[model samples]
Each structure stands twice: as structure tokens, then as C-alpha cells.
Target: MSDQLQNLDLPYFAIFLTFFLAVLSSLLVLAPTQRGISATWDYLKQVKFIERNGIVVSTYIVIAVSLWVVVMIVAPQFFMVELSFHDGTVAADVNYDYSQTPYTFNNYSYVIFGSGSDDSYFNVLHLKVFLRTIIASVCITLLAFVLCYPIAYYMAQTAKGGTVRLLLICLVLPFWVNEILRAFAFRILFGSSGVINSVLIGSGIMDEPFDFIKADIAMYAGLSYAYILLMIFPIYNAIESLDHNQIEAARDLGSSWSRIHYRVVMPYAKPGIASGCTMVFMLTAGALAAPQILGGPSSLWFTQIITNWFNLGDWTRGSAYAFLFLLSCIVFVLTVMKYFKVNLGELAK
Candidate 1:
């Protein structure tokens, strides 16, 4: 086979060809009457083995435990250790030594405390950026949930298919535009000479144009707009799958609207809410573009710090920060899974 075909990794194709030939050969070897006898004999042999179940059960348990150990514990630690060894290296000619030394906790210490050298190290500003990112992510996730839940619930309960379809289309329409273009559009709208200010000034709504770009309000609005659809779809799917009869039954039993929602609808929709929150939190936490454009100079987010470290040839600190963010995402996902009592693996499907 050509290199290009080999690179396609057609192992499954090869397996299918082999299996087809084996089946054809088996059919040729066995006469039509003997096929039934062979099948019955094979079944009897398998049933006889099943009668001796202890060894089979023990072997299955051992295989499952071994797979779990490799997947859950050993694999991640192995990769983290491998990445740590080659974390930081300078490409261009510089006075700094780029020695591949033995692995040590120096990278962790530098990430926690300022290194006070050419090597990029964690600082108070970095910490502030990290904290601000957490705060921003939490705010965005909460606000998205608040806004999305009502719309999702309305769409789920209402029978107006045309209106629901229109709303869903409109919600997803912004995503068709390029993300950077959308961010720039927001930037223009919130900029000093943008349309919002011009209209407000023209209408005498305020004396001066609001400084939205330098403020947190602009960041919140932009990020929320970016991730709103992600928050909506999961909740919508969740609520759609719910049994509306149970909800009507609750109301028939003299339950108030609030009681019906809290008691009947919310529990069923917990999986969707958890899934949506996980997505929104993770996306907002790692947001780079919206903050960079809308936040101006004052609101430097965690991603910008990573960018700076990368620019300064400080891969170690950058990797450390990246890993930390990854850990946070994992923890947040696990927490959501725990709260909803849903297996993340199953929900992800």
C-alpha cells in the first residue's frame, strides 16, 4: 500500500477482509447439513464452559480492575510527568541556559512564588488575573443559567412549534458569523464612537458616552453573548425529554406553578442543567478573545498572562498555568456530575 493509504490507518478494513475470507473458507469446508451440527456442537461447548463460571467471573473482574487502574490513575500521572521534563525551552539565541536537567519541584515552586529572574514566574498580577477569571466565569455561568432556564422551560412546555423553532434559530444565528467578527462587532458597538453611544447622545439619554470598553460590564455582556447558545441547547434538550404528563399531574393535584416547577420539572432537568453549567463554566474560564478586546488594558485576564509567559519564552510557567486551568475544569466537571448524580461519561455521549 502507498504511504498515504497506510497513514489512513485501515486496520479495521484489513480485519473485515480477513473475517470475510475466513467465513467463506469455513462455509466451503462445512457441508450444508454439517453446518447445523457444527453450530450446535459449538453452542454446547460454550454452555458447558458457562457451567464452570467462577474462573470466568474472576478473569472478567481482574481485566476490569486492571483497565480502571490504567485509565483513572496511571495514564494521567505518566503524561504530566513526561510534560514536566520538557516544559520550558527557549528557541532563539539567548544568554539563558537551556539545560535538560533532572525533574524537580522547582517549576511548581516558581509557579507558586515569583522567580525574580528571566524565567517567567508566578506573580501577584498573575494571581489577580486567575482570581478575576474565576469570578468572571462564575458570574457568566450563573447569569447564563438564569437566562437560559426560562427560555428552555418555555420552549419545552409551549406547543407553539413555529415560535420555538424561530427562537432556536435566532439563538444559534450569531454563531454563524465568525467569532472574531462578533467580538469586533461588540467592540465597535461599545467603543467611544460606536452606535450605542451615538444613539444615546443623539436622544439625550445621557450627557456623555458610557465607557463600556474599559469596564467589566462590556466583558460580561460580550462573553455572555458568546456562550449563551451553549447554555441554552443542553437545558432545552433536557426539558424536552421530560414527561409533561407528570407536570400536568402535579398542577392537577392543586400544586402551584412554583411547586410544580421545583418538585416535578427541576429534578428531571438536573442532568441538562449540570451539563450546561459544565460547558459554560469551562468555556468562560478559558475565554481569551472577549476579554482581550472588550476588557481594554485594565482587565487583564488569566489567558493574557499565559500569552505573556509564552511570548517571553517561559513555557514552564505557561504549562503550569495551563495544567492548573485543566485541573479546575476537571474538578468543576466532577462537582457537577456529583451534584446531578449522573455519570459524566454517559452524559458526554
Candidate 2:
């Protein structure tokens, strides 16, 4: 076997193998691609607006959407996942040859298990940070929901025109400033000698300033506040579409506020609640500015580790971490949908 292998034309064999795989892949994808194209064309032809908008305008719209999906979304992700398979050490080298470099799953392995030098098998430190980030994000999502639901209910069902306008202005006012600036404002307000502490001391309500920043309270508050509008608007939209007569009927039946919301209001607002929760959770998980500015000294967010890897030129590991984070977020969204019994089409609404 060794003698025969040594006698073979290795380069020619490699070329033949590559060509064979390419042909096989193309054959596999060709049928599905053709079917998708045919379906899209049929749908476009049946669309009502095509007659008014004309073929040229419709063609331009399709082109724009395709370009946006391919260029802005798909291409970057494809490159990222491609880069993740390479050895981080080799990928970081300035003079490295891409084709000659070997691929390895060490980046992902390190994410799951400890470095080879470690006595323990699991990557406890990184896993702990990842779990903490997920839990904190969930808490922030729930906090936003709790704070926004009442305001949303009022805006949808009870508030008069002038009152609604006033509430909207108040809600939208703080968001006019940059997010980092808002985080900084929270930092100031929650600082030891900041407004809250000062007021408490001035009124003789407390003896010494509390360390809200060190306790991680500021980070939580900032995260909750940052995405409050996202939580509010969706619930309000869902509740607004709900008929007022149902709430009136519930009240006429002597239903308590809690019972009304639990049985009637909430079931109708499932899609909106699910959408808002998904948005808030994803945003909170990905947030860097608020956590960096307001987080306690001991706090750690998972994105910070990913940023560190990229900043240090370990693109392979960074991409792996990023793809992992993206996958986790996608799983979370799917879980939320399953739990709420809502589908993607309903959530989109």
C-alpha cells in the first residue's frame, strides 16, 4: 500500500477530487435553486401592484432587496463562519498563505473545554461568563416588560389624546440622546455621591452613600431603560388592535384587573409580547456600551471577551465566538416563539 501510494500522482489526484466534489455540489443545489427561482417568478407575476408599478420598478425593488440581503447580511456571515475553521495562530500571521494554512476546530474546542494545559476538562470561566450574560439578558427583558406593560395598556386603552401626547414626549425624550451618553448619565446618577445618594443624605434618610455601581444595579437599570421603547411600542400596537368592548365586558363581569390581563389582554397580545421579548433579549445580550460604562468592577459580559479576541488579531477565535453567540441568540428566539405558541409570521406582525 505504501509503495503504491508513493508512486501515485498526488497533485493530479487532488485536482480530480476537487473537480468531483464541485460537480457533485452543483448537481445537488441546481434543482432547488431552479425551483426557488420559478416560485419567486410566479409569485411576482401574481402580485397586484406589478400592473401599476410596472416591470421596471418591480425589477428594481427585487434587485435592491437581493443586494441588501446578499451584501449586507449573507456575505459577511459566510466569511465569518469560513474564517472560524482556520487556526487562529496562522490566521493572525501577516505573511500567511491562505490555501496552505490548515483548518482546525481548536477555537470551538477551547470554547467548550479548557485549554490543554488545564487540569479540568470544561472551560468553566468562559462558560460561567456566557451563562451569566444569558441570565442577565433575560432579567433585563423581564424588567423592561414589567415596566412597559402598564404604560402600554394606558396608551392603548385609556389615555386621552393630550395625555397620550404628553406620555409619548416623555418616553421619547431621553432616547434623543446617544445611548452611550445615557449610560454615562446612569453612571453619574448611580455613583456613590451622585444625585440619588446626595438626596438621601440631604434628607437624612441615610448615613453613607450606597455603592450602586459596584452592585451592578446601574448596569441592569441602564439595560432595562435602553430598550424600554422596543418593549412598549409592540405591546401597545397589539393592545390597540384589541377591542375595548372585551375589557368592558370583563369589567362588567366583575373581573379583577389581574384576571382581565391574565385571561383576555395577555392572550391577545401574545405575538407582540413575544416579539418585544425577543428584541429586548437579543439587544441586551449584544449590548456593549451600557455594560462597559455602568457594570460593576466584577461584572463580565460575553461580548467583551469576543471583542478582546478580535482586538488581539485572533480573528479565527473571534469569529468562532461571534458565530456561537449568534447561534445562541437564534436558539433563544426560537424557544421564545415555541413557549408563546407564536410562529415567525405572527411575530413579524
Candidate 3:
């Protein structure tokens, strides 16, 4: 048995086995409850709980607090931090070492303030990437919302099942193909000397093919295509749940189409807009592949900073970048929540 266990290849097998055994032992201890012997004791315990809902809730709180204590006190010290060396000479291997660690803010200072002769703590390239990420995310979200809003409204207002189903199928059909393949297909279409240019030039629209690759226009177009469905589905569901009677009542009171939409429909669709914007923002901010392939060397985004850090074996700096990105996202979310006057609980509803 020991030899067999030693030969086991599964990394988490021991942990799973321990949990299984603990559960099995618990079941065994509770087995007497299945018989009449422990029935009276169980009933007594249940009756004692009637006067102590507060006590039950308090017990849960205490257990949760204890679990957190264990995690905070025991986990961090035991877990080792892995480091990698990649000087571009040999195969980089992870090493666990903290022997010469200093009890100061040296690492943070070095990352933030830079080393001698470098003269800067933060990388300017990274700053550029971060700004580009924000710009790209905002552009994608706005473009997607503009393109999807009308389609979603139409889908919601339409009553015919066949038409709605067909529209939905058309909306989602692109997803049937793999995302990378779709991106590459866009790349092909929008590349210099591609179909659009060929047709335009052949029709005497221009003398030369337009340079579509690595342009901001191409990046926005590609990202908008990728994320339009995300924006559409949420807004469609939100608008579908709206009461049509309200719109009819507004119309009866002589409200114009624009007035009805602005006053009645827009407020209800806020939650969906919030959700879709959040999704698009996060996805586009962290996007690496699309920018790399379509936008090429000219376009830089924050995720590329993460990639550079990882490739250079700078885990601490990479973690810092991730946390900074998270902080920015949280701030944006909070701002939106405040502006909309909607809490997370309301949005969830």
C-alpha cells in the first residue's frame, strides 16, 4: 500500500484522500442517528436550537473567523515563493530561496524607483501600455454598445419567435468558430491588399490599397466584432424584462418615441449596460493576442507589460502590475456604481 501510494502520480491525491477519510469518519460517527438510539438526543438538540437562531448565526460567524485565522496564521509562512532566472542564456528553472532576504522595502523601492543609471522607478513603456489599454477598452465598449443597442432593442420588441430565433442565431453564429480563428480571419480581411482594398481599388475608389493593419481603426473594428455579442445579450435580456404597458401608457400620454426610450427604457437597461461594459472593459484591458496580431508592434496595452514581466522572470513586479490593474478596475466600478445609484445587490437582482 505504501509503495502504491508512493508511486501515485496525482499531485493533489493526498489532500483529497485526507478529506475523504475525514468525511467517512464523520459519517461513521453519525451512523447511530439512523437508528432509534440517537433519535432522542438529536431531537433534544433541534429543540434547543429554536430559542437560539442568534446563537446559530454566531456559531457560523465564529467558525468563519476561526478559518480565516488559520489561513492567515498558518498559510503564508508555509507557502514558499518561487523565483525564476531568465538571463537568456540557459533554461530558466524555478528556485525557492529567501536566505539573504532583507527586512526592508528594498524590493518595492527597486521596482518603483529603479536601479542606478536606470533613473526611473516605473517603466515609461509600461505607462504607455496602461494608457493604451484604457483607451482600447473604452473604445471597444462604446462601439459595441452603439452597434448592439439597436439590435437588442429590436430583438426585445419583436414578438415573432421565428424571427427572434433567427436573429439570435445570426448574432451567435460567429462564436461557433474558434476565437483565434475568427481573429485571424478578421486579420486576413483587414490586412493590407486584402478583400476590402481589392474591391475598393478595383472599383476605382482609390489608386492604392489602404493600410489597415496596425491601425487604431483596425484594432477597434476587430475588438468590437469580438465583444459585440457580450454587449447585445445582456441588454437584450434587460430590455425584454421591461413592461411594455409602461411604454404604451407613455405613448397614450403623447410621449414621443425618443422621450419614451430616454425616460422609460433607458433606466431599466442600466443594469445590463453596467454588466456588459464591465465585461468588455476587463476583457479588452487584459487582451494580448488581438493587439499583438492585428495592431502589431505599434499598439501596446497593459497586458503586454504583464507578459514582459513574466518573460523577464519578474514575478514581484508582475504581481504589482496585476494589483494596480485590479485597483483601477475597482475604482472604475465604484465610480459607475455611484453614478448609476445602484449597488451590487440591486444590479444582481
Candidate 4:
């Protein structure tokens, strides 16, 4: 840890170099050796297809794809996975890069098993938070759907041109402010001496102020509001495409309002419902700002654990936590898709 020590990154550099060389060698072996270089050489000859699009367009596409793959997605995640497998230590604590430390499952084991004993507080607390997050996210999605459906229907179907434009402006106005600022606004509204309390107390509605944040109501409300737009637009787009004549014909057949919506509107909106619910659920589960700003002490989301690990200089544990969270969200998405009987192509629409 002392300044007198030589470069501590040397060991880590050596390990990285080894990994790079191994991958490069494998790629080289996979390249063709026949006709000039081999099948790989023949593959390079396939560049003619790209050239058909014109050199400029081909060059731009290649650069964009390469950047997306290497910089935006693969490289960072690849290193994070590598970090997750290694037991990371502070560089200041040793003479070497600590790269000599054997790779481990300790980070993942800590998460799956617990921070301490099998039934420790951390183990129980984290599990509880994870479950609560999933349940709360689903609840938020349902709430948003219920609240937005009527408004979306009116806007997309019944509203005239001016009314539609006005409603859209209303929706966009609230989001012009920063998301964190909106969260803080919710915090103020729910605080003990804040707007709700002032009105309730003035009206003699209760004997004392209610702690909405402590009760976690603020978190639920904030999350639902935060992702409301995601739910609205998808359903709007789906319903907008439906023929009004079908609804009129159903009404002519003496189908009640409930039956009309149940049999007609909902079937047409299935893809939108699936898409919106999945997006809301994922966003709500991964939410940090709303929970941090508005949730009570009891409302511990999984992202908080990831942040704590990083602040404690434990990148391995943090990466493991992040990866696991991603896997859980992916599973939830697949479940939503299955329940709606919609494939990826349908959902995209």
C-alpha cells in the first residue's frame, strides 16, 4: 500500500495480456489457410456485398456496428464478467496487482448464500428486498395500466385533432423537468409536514400527520407515475390502429361496454399491453432515484446493494449483483411475453 512500492498494476496487466493473446491465437487458428489465407481469406472476399451499398455507407455501417459491439456492449460487460470471477482487492493494499489471487465464485456465493451465515440478516434482508422489488414493480405496472387506459383510449380514439394535441402537451409538460426533481417533488408532497399533511390537518381529517414515505406509499406512487408514459404510448398505438367500425358493430349487436372492451379492445391491444407492462416492470425494478428519494428505511432495493459494494471497493461483488439483477429482469420479461402469448416480433409492433 505504501508509495515506495513499484507499479501495483503489473500483475493485472500480465493477466490481461495473457487473455488477449489467447483470444487472438484462437481467432487466428479459426481463419482460413487455404487460397491465400484460407476460408477466412475467402470470407474477407465477401466484403464485395458491403461495397454494393457504396463505400461511404458501408464504411459508416461497419464503424457503427463495431462501436456498438466493442464499446457499447461487449467490452465493458466482458471485463465485468472477468472481474466478477476474480477476487478483487484494493491496489493500495499490496506489492502486486492482486491479480495472483485465484478466480472465485465467492462474490456470487455471497449473494446466493448470504453475507454471513445461511440465515443472517443480510441474507434475509436482501431476499426480502428482491422479492418486494419484483412485486412492487408488477403492482406499479398494473396501476399505471389501470390509470392510463381510459386517458389513452380517449386520446387515441375519441379525441379531435386539437384535443389530442392538447393532451399530448399535458403529458410532455411534466417530463420537461428532471426525473430526480420530480422525485423530490413527491418527497415534499409526502413528507410529514408537507402538502398532504397541511391539507389533512387543516381539514381535521386526522389527529396527526401520516408518514407516507415511512409507509412506502410514496415509493409506489412515484414509481407508477415515473413510468406512466411507457404504459400509455404502447397501448395508445395499438388501440389507435383498431377500426372503430368493429366497436360500433359490437355495440349494434347489443354487446355491453364491458364485453366490448374485454372481447374487442383488449384482444387488439395484447401486444401493447405486454410491451408496456414488461417495460414498466423492468424500469421499476431497476429504479434507483425514486426509491432513494422517496422510499423509507424499509424500502431497500437491490440496486442499493450494488452501489454499496462498489463504494466498498468490491467490484467483483458489485458486478455479480448487477449481472444477477439483469438475469432476473430478463426472466421476468420472458414470463410476461409468455403470459401474453406474444413473441418478440409481435411485441416489437
Rank list by TM-score? 2, 4, 1, 3
**Candidate scoring better on TM-score of 3 and 4:** 4
- Per-residue alpha-carbon lDDT of candidate 4 for residues 69-99, written as tens digits (9 for 90 to 100): 5786657766665676567653424332434
RMSD of each: 14.4, 6.6, 12.2, 7.6
Provide the lowest-lDDT 10-residue window in model 4.
27-36
Give the 10-residue window scoring lowest on summed lDDT in candidate 2: 26-35
Candidate models: Cα lDDT each: 0.70, 0.82, 0.65, 0.78
Error of 4 at 259 (Å): 1.7
Residue-by-residue lDDT tens digits, candidate 1, 71-92: 7645554444333433264342
Model 3 TM-score (2 dp): 0.69
Name the candidate that leads on lDDT.
2
lDDT (tens digit, per residue) of candidate 3 on 1-349: 5754564445444443453344344323323333343674477467764356567785786578557644763333122111111111233346523222222233334334545356565655556667768876887888888888889988997557799999999888988987777778878888777888789898999898788875556666787888778888888989999988988999999999999888998788988877777777778777777776678657776777767776776554554565457557656765777787855544443
In TM-score terms, candidate 1 sits at 0.70
Q: Count the backbone clashes (under 3 Å) in each candidate.
A: 0, 0, 3, 7
Global Cα lDDT for candidate 4: 0.78
Off by over 4 Å in 4: 1-55, 89-100, 118-122
